[model samples]
Target: MLLISRENRELLRIIEEQKPSSLKELEAATGRKRSNLYRTLSTMAQYGIVDLVRSNKRVKPVVKATSFQVEFGLDEPSQHEKRRS
Candidate 1:
């Protein structure tokens, strides 16, 4: 199973629902700093769950996945759990 953190999920929700045109707008919507949001969004990009589009000097975050599912796992903890430990 692959699980996203609660905060990341909220970020995705804002991106999908609000469709902010730039990171600045997203920051305003989420009440998070641009620097921290950029780091978090960058990580989500690595998972192909979000796309960061750059135009001129602005970066826009687009949500690629709105929902996620679980697959059977042997014994290993999910990435989300591992991060907690």
Candidate 2:
């Protein structure tokens, strides 16, 4: 999933610092539209970057991951090839 972006990073920061109780509160804190925040947070939730908790009939966003590590090697054999061998 494409999770690294300026807007997403900012949203993470806000969630970490403000700790808003619900999406509406987050919308106010970030001055972003509710629809936009919902879409973005939904995507983040799917990627396990954040958690959407339902409390008191409100959806709250919680940051589950604070950092990321990416590793790739071109010299490594493909998984399909290794399995065949």
Candidate 3:
């Protein structure tokens, strides 16, 4: 199961509520340092959960999903389950 940390959830909320146009704006909205926000946003971007658009010298974070659902033990075989012969 994938886990969305509390901090990441807050970041998503900030993006959805404020719709910041740049990293600086997001920093202001979230009260987080730009450098830290950049790193976290970068990681989120890689996971396709967030989009970081680069224009001129600014990177804007866009929220793709305000919330997510996780399913556990659905895709994986249980320990007691055995391979089919």
Candidate 4:
């Protein structure tokens, strides 16, 4: 079944909180260390769930969810997914 992982949830949370903001500020606010936050950001970026805004001395990435209410479950696959299954 398609699903979001725990790290994905945490990443989404961080983005929601830091959104329209920056990761350095997010680290301060969320108490997540830079390393951990960066790793999550990179993974989320790969999934197209987040986007990088700019890269420089500091990276300012933004989050973009597939939907405001994306499904995060472990149920049987949908018809489309079942085909792949």
Candidate 5:
């Protein structure tokens, strides 16, 4: 799943603003199901976007990144490469 998807962006916003203490509280705050939230958050955790901390037997979601940087290029060679070729 893309980290910058609309749903994920919204989830990041909620986590940053509300700072819910548990998954249940996050579920209520976002109006999303526990299963779905867990799945999404787990994925985000894997990407270093958020951290799922265990406290008092509850998992707390913490935002680690609020912005993203994307860089891409076509398969064609660059001007410098063409010059060398």
Candidate 6:
């Protein structure tokens, strides 16, 4: 159950729009630094938020998910609230 930050939500949106994406492609698409993007991807990977789809030498990393769903339970804090605190 991911809290679904703005960045994570945007990443999912980009994935849905692009179908498949690599690290470089996503970095470019989101205008985020490669290192930061990688960190976010790693976090998502740790949570099973995204599935690694493909990779290439010239291109960036790629991933896919059944659906971009943010499962925020009543007990969990809202992303906005988390950010505030």
Task: Give a tens-digit lDDT track for model 3, residues 1-84.
Answer: 123788778788889888999999998888899998988888878878899999999999998867677667777776667555
- Model 2, residue pairs in steric clash: none
* True-structure RMSD, every candidate: 5.9, 3.6, 4.3, 5.9, 5.8, 7.1
* TM-score against native, each model: 0.77, 0.77, 0.75, 0.58, 0.80, 0.57
Q: Largest TM-score belongs to which candidate?
A: 5
Whole-model alpha-carbon lDDT for candidate 4: 0.69
Displacement of residue 74 (Cα, Å) in model 1 is: 3.8
**Among these predicted structures, which one has the highest lDDT?**
5
lDDT of 1 by residue, 6-85 (tens): 88788899899999999999999999999988988888889888999999999999998887776887798889999999
Q: lDDT at 20 for candidate 6?
A: 46
Q: Lowest summed lDDT over 10 consecutive residues: which window, candidate 6?
A: 54-63
- The per-residue C-alpha lDDT of model 3 at residue 11 equals 82
lDDT of 6 by residue, 33-64 (tens): 87876677777777777665544543344445
Q: How close is candidate 3 to the true structure, as a TM-score?
A: 0.75
| Candidate 4 to truth, TM | 0.58
Query: Which 10 successive residues of model 4 have the least lDDT summed?
Result: 1-10
Q: Cα lDDT of model 2 overall?
A: 0.90
Q: Rank the candidates by lDDT, best first.
A: 5, 2, 1, 3, 4, 6
**Residues forming the 10-long window of minimal summed lDDT in candidate 5:** 1-10
Q: What is the C-alpha lDDT of each candidate?
A: 0.88, 0.90, 0.84, 0.69, 0.92, 0.67
Q: lDDT score, residue 51, model 6?
A: 60
For each predicted model, how many residue pairs clash, with residues at least 3 apart or on different chains? 0, 0, 0, 0, 0, 2
Q: Please state the error at residue 82 of candidate 4 in Å.
A: 19
For model 1, where is the 10-residue window of minimal lDDT?
1-10
